[model samples]
Target: MKRLLIFYFLFFPVFLLSEKRDVYAISDGKGNIKLFWLTSPKNYPSGGWRIEEEKTNKVIEKQLYCGREEFLNALKEEEKGLAKNFIKIFKDDDKEKKGKKFLIVLEAMTNWNFAQAIGIGYEIKDVPKGKVRYKIIGLDESGKKVGPHFLSDFLDSSVETLPPDAPENLKAEIILREVKLSWSQPKEKGVIPSVFFNVERDGKVLNLNPIIPSGEDSSFLDKEPPSLMEVNYFVYGVDVFGRKSIIKKISIYVPDLKGMVPPENFTAEEKSGKIILRWKKVENSSGYIIERSNLSNSLYEILTPKGIQPDMEYYEDSNLQGGSVYYYRIHSYGRDGKIGPPSLVAFAQAKNQTPPPKPKNLKAKVGRTMVQLMWDRVDFPVAGYRIERKAEGKEKWDRLNEKLTPEPNYNDITGLYTQGKFKYRVIAVAYDEKESLPSEEVEVELLDTVSPNPPRITNIESFDGVVKIYFEPSPPEEDVFNFLIVRGVSEEDPGLVIGEPLSKEKREFEDKFVKIGQRYWYRVVAIDKKGNRSDLSSSRDINV
Candidate 1:
């Protein structure tokens, strides 16, 4: 019984398929009118069927369906109601040979709603051969039906479908004060959709209609500036399906600060020979002006027109007098016509000056064998001075005293040879230790008056790792003015050693560095306690 039941179910579908009619529908590509025909079922015994379209319950187009003859006649009648000239009807036989399929185009009819009226509908029946059948249906130009060619039907059921009500929740978001806005795009199938956004500000909509590419961002920049004060605007989004979303509104506010009171905090200062000024920067101040004047004068000068930075605490007045005093002040201005009070008074004094004059009447003289130097005192305070002398025809001058008395006179005649000519000069010095130019030079020659005999050698000793050769001049009053010691390897050829100069009243003299086994030569010259030296005595060789 189950096998029989399965057999009957399969056979029942075949019988029903055989009794089904083959229907075909077509449009003239332009109107609300459509033509449809149905072949009579074999058992039903009807030869053909008729079709009709109605609006507001009134028939718009009624026709009988036959073969190609009836299809062409119905298409001609429908064309009368179309506003556009291009009209066509596709047939099954024509599509089969050309590897094409039946296509229909129908005009959209308005049922009182303008947004809903702008659409076209098409239908295709008997798609598959024999017992199996399919119908294809679609909509075209549902909004703003202005174009010539549009999609009306789907060839396959697997093709993606789209929503019938366009996109919902279309909105505009004002992202910033610069009139930047964003919106949501429409969702559709089979075709990549494009979006367009319109912006309106200050009662006038912007003329730029920007097309948003597929999958691109849905934001826009409203570069057009709005009016002063608060502004109003409207925005909307349009999709590639000729569908437009609802409008959105936005408001913006702009402020003014004119005629407002400005604040103050300006200041100034006085530095070396200059006036420096500065002021505190106002929040919106364009710039500041600096004015200056001498405390004793009435004329004031503007220093800087552009306001200074609030943190730039100081400025310089590089043109002030060296010994004169000056005063300075500063002022600040703002864009709101506000003026700041003058800064505190600042005073500056110039520097002092006092320079020393040169010395005068410098002279040098010779007394006996000593050279005497003298100079007039300088009016200014001074440290001790120096005396300089040079022998006649010598290239270098010698300093007699490193730093002598503050007095103007000096006697520097020691260490001079008899019959030798010499020159002498003096220099005056100031408290800062600055020395004046040298005094006028005086040249003099010394003459031998008397001679003193050589003293006897005595008291040879060694001290501090050094050998000291001492001698005593005979007759203490006699002047043993100068002495000489010479050293050599041999006594008979002993070389003379030079000795430093000594005073005439001195009795003893010490010679340093007498090495053992080395023969040394000694000679002493003396005058009878006078300003003279005796002839060299025969050499004395000392061995240690």
Candidate 2:
């Protein structure tokens, strides 16, 4: 039931170069599986490794080669320069539990430490495609071996041949006697995102190890190829598991010194009103032929009238349907109208070509608290509009709306305190967030009509048979003219303002005029500089 099939190199590299020793598995298309791993240095002192299955506490005997006698006979065919010793499967004195078979491999004697890394290329024949649970544990010696030995976690390896995709668009550029091969990486959807490539010439591998893609392509230079004769080259992708993709083959005849090859680094991209196609200039080429195709893998139509001059390496195709993908391929011609071989196909999609018209009829309505902005909505379809604000003398304009405004209106309240000249502008935005020129700017100075919130009468103290009131001041402190302290005898009574209106800074007052045995509720009111009165504050009663 444990299902974690790490795609070898990407998640955990199949090469256990580090100290961890977990088993990795891969299956051939046939019913055979190869379980491979290197012995960790941490297990060198652990004497040996034992493969135990948790289900039956038994060993899959067919998967392992046991004993010096059996290992020597099996190695008769395999080359052997280094000699290693082996130890017994189990210790004599301590035998609490003993597995039936010697699950330990002959490479199991990790004590001396392997000079060369051990590979488990020995395939387990006739093994099932999935669910092969093998628990490889280091014989515990002290506590150092604990790092590599995953005692609790089972190696529930799902062994199957999930080969990586083959490299795409394999191309060969034949120059005289040399052949240069290039290929784009395959689009892989599995956990394994990348693979090293292998190139073969005439069924012989050119590279000993697999080659990794460098930039846009994986390339190889076959400097020495057969002269004049057509030689076939093959390229394939291989993952860390040693599983390979279907090989892509290309046949090429080495060209002479006078012969020209196709242009290199061919690319296509969408520019203003056209899809631009470009390629590196081919030396000594007379002319170039350009062909375009709307559908991939279909017949192509020559887009050029005669042929593009040798000096020009770029062509712009302006006659295109918007949002349609177009494929282009180009090849160069030598002096004798000898067309060079095989050009790479590149494609690009044309986009919406024109800019949207700028927003119009911008206007601003001034209010004391905020400026209400409005503009004539764009008649053409657009994503939305953006609002930006600027002060009178400031050259930089800051955007007021965080997101595009769906409607043609916005309310801005920021920076209204400073009574200064402000300017507003609206920009029309395209679906791709492309902005049009700013609308005609509108300038306005805000009017003063906002009122300050009422202050709260916090605590009213009655000590020594006298009542005193303490209140908190309301903001904006700059706008408040003064505080109005009101006194009321009952809930329904209209409070009377006491001591003509207190100073703006004053927050408390001693009510010496209150007679003994009198109860009264106190309230506070704030008036802004524009004479706008705030609502009365909640009342607090005092007893004398």
Candidate 3:
């Protein structure tokens, strides 16, 4: 007799992923998927994933991770703890040989109940060029088969992939009553599956579209810029396959009072920290309104909130941000309060009157082996930033970053093995290599943010109705707070923390909690003084 197996699709309807974020999938362009997703808040005892061919409906690979124990046992052990190891993105075939092990990337870094996390997912590689469906299930801890959640994601081998660069130099300028937006056309000209332009306003994309390429540029006009002064525009270049280019954003400022013959010869000159503006007077106008802004990205600030007298032909505007462009315009009005159209826009670059200002809001996040730092962006133009560190009680400061980091954050691994008092400072560097004053020093007393390494089990023995588990200590004996003996039916089960948490000096523990004619597998777990737990040691099984 031939037996048949079947999976009813209707029974698992709730597992269907209705959200795009169920499992984030992106193609590396080399036939592999880069995936990551949020962790469960319910602390499911077992979480699993299954990958199946969409058309053939055949499962290729799957895993049922009962907890940290099973997940750790499946992968290589690392000293950096679970958080860093969990969120790593792999691109090559080397990871495929490991039989699927994921290190815990974060533990203390996230509060599991609130700000949930998505990390340590499958490193699926060398996938065929077609549709692949994946399922992630969260099983309960109470021994009830009830599931807290199930996520089913459908990923095509063609997962929304695109080239790194978006259209270059996106510009938005005021063209009379309309706003003109344009970008450099694709170097290799094409349409549809190649590269085509799409314009989106506020957020809604225009369904009926038309693109006319004129020379090296393609442009679009926001026929109706919602009677607003400042509008944000997101521009994309999508192909026929629906894959999109990196989104370029533009903030366009459309003036309300416009179109009347503006003042002529309106000119602005850079003078230290201020811009000096002068313009020819318009006949029959008694007063004028002066406005200034950063380029054309934002609404202009009215310089003459109380109206400038016609006699004031020139005004000195000193309130400005360092190393930035300032655009200015003037409007003339009659005896009536009605304001006339704005004049020709004049822009000038403001110079750095003094040196760059001090950086602010320097903060640190203590990680397993390193401390990550972040600070607010400097308002002035900077080539990059330099970071310096000094050990507590040390008189000299040591430069930590060899090269100026273009980004505002840095990771300091300097006291990784030992906890100490450390101080850090940051400075801005101009493109000319000139340096700014160092920011206020931030001091941190490093703690044991890292866990101890997994211990190695050498021998196990059973006699007199008791089981003895022996392991070699990996951390300094004094730093170890205790050792836990985990006994389970299966070595992979993160079995109960049995017996008392043993002292640091003991390399072995005896377990008397057992039943006759039963089987048990034992493993060792260690904890450091600061309460960081080590991974479960390799297992050894014995029959009672």
Candidate 4:
């Protein structure tokens, strides 16, 4: 009994193992290998095993599997041996031939165990100079299969290339200020078409629409035109295949001031010793009326009747006195008693009748190294006058005096420091201080003088990022002189003085520092070598 039991345990398992079959094949596109195994009647599990390449050797991917129908279907469709050659045998021959085939795809270029178990195979298509490969593997019954096999040789690799061309029948139109667009579908079936349109104005992209379906006509009216008034626009087109066509420009004119009356060009200016007013012709104007006022007056006086041409823009005011200022305005009256708003204010000053009086003898004198000038005031009861002077080397005379009194004599003659000869002249003042005819001038030469007094520092103040020092330069005999600036932070630190010995005529200096939010105190003084130094100017304190 013990011996029989031992034989039964071992023999039963062996009998079951023989009932199943493992089948596989290899393919290199052009050729194929197959296997067949004799087996007793037994049902195999629906899934199968596979083998693939890892650089060199054929490796098994044990757990890797696929459905029978899917495996067979992939083989028939692709004609790739990797999946089709691996078959599961059954008791019925016809059923075996018709069973589905599952093709298992494994990631190439990896060391994964399951990927190795399935043999790697590929299908190839024409790509440039080389073949474009799609990888696949196989699965079979008994959970044992071989190959991701190469099946490129089995495929038709010939392919055709087409030149890029515009999508057919592309058209765009503007409707009610919106752009409506349409285009023909691509020749290649199942190709997704994309469309793009842009609204352009003055070579600028005013609006853009992208990624629309082909064969679709659409409108994109710009709700807001580029400006408050009307403008022109153009349309551009592009198809899904990235083909673009020339732009179609369209002009759109928007009316300005629609239904509103146009304004006439009303102008006012001084002419013929009077205020003249003019305007453009108004077709239906009843007549034009002129208004006048003084500088201080606010009321306007109408001076014309109806039925007069609004185009007869000219109007003159002769009832004004000389040297008087006046303001004028105009308006249009319709037959319906409608009056336009007052035109812009026009102003004119009456021409001057009084002549300017002759300037008195103008004389120049030398004081130390400086030239002192004096003249008799203008004789007329006028506004004012100007003075002019020129040196021997100068080509043009310069105005040296202005707005002198109406008295008989005046004195200036200051700021002349040059040693050469100089000439001078004066003119009378007219209306509004306008200078009139010139008076004869006298020539004079300035004498050289000794150095002037040095300037003195008066006061100092410090503020944010800067220190301000104030001083007065020494007054010299010659008024035409400039001053130099110098500064120092500490009173006792002579070495810390910032600049060379500055001119005594300098009045102020500002120093900048990097430190902030600090308090500083400063002092200034005025000195003149020719004159005594004034007492040190007041000191100032500031925080920066």
Root-mean-square deviation per candidate: 23.7, 21.7, 40.5, 29.3
- Candidate 1 local lDDT, 1-544, one digit each (tens): 0011111122122111111223222222222212221211111111111122211222222211122332233333443223121122222234442221101111111111111111122233322222112231221223221212111222233232231222334343332224455544444333322234556665665745443322323455665444235656676554323334456666654222221113344444454435555544445444445566666356667766655654455677675444455665655544443445554555555332332344567665655656666777766555666777787789889988866667878877554344567777766665434556765667767654546665666655555545565666666543555555444556566455556666654555565556655555565655543456656555555555
Instruction: Please count the clashing residue pairs in each candidate, in the order shown.
Output: 18, 0, 8, 64
Query: lDDT of each model, Cα atoms only?
Result: 0.43, 0.64, 0.62, 0.44
Which scores higher on lDDT, 1 or 4?
A: 4
Cα displacement (angstroms), candidate 2, residue 108, comes to 16
What local lDDT does model 1 show for residue 236?
A: 57
Q: Write out the backbone clash pairs for model 2.
A: none
| Residue ranges of candidate 4 with Cα displaced over 4 Å | 1-267, 278-327, 330-343, 347-358, 361-386, 392-396, 401-421, 428-437, 445-544
User: Candidate 3: misplaced stretches above 4 Å?
Assistant: 1-264, 280-289, 293-302, 305-312, 331-343, 355-422, 426-436, 474-481, 490-493
Candidate 4's displacement at residue 316, Å, is 3.5
State candidate 1's TM-score. Answer: 0.24
**Candidate 4 overall lDDT versus native:** 0.44
Task: Kindly indicate the candidate among 1 and 3 with the higher lDDT.
Answer: 3
* lDDT (10s digit) by residue, model 2, range 333-357: 7666756664789999776566567
lDDT of 3 by residue, 118-207 (tens): 222444678877766655444343333344333445555655454423566789986544678888755432211222467788678853
The true-versus-predicted C-alpha distance at residue 534 of model 2, in Å, is: 88
Regions of candidate 1 where Cα sits further than 4 Å from its true position: 1-194, 202-205, 208-225, 232-234, 244-251, 255-509, 512-544
- Which is the winner by TM-score between candidate 1 and candidate 4? 1
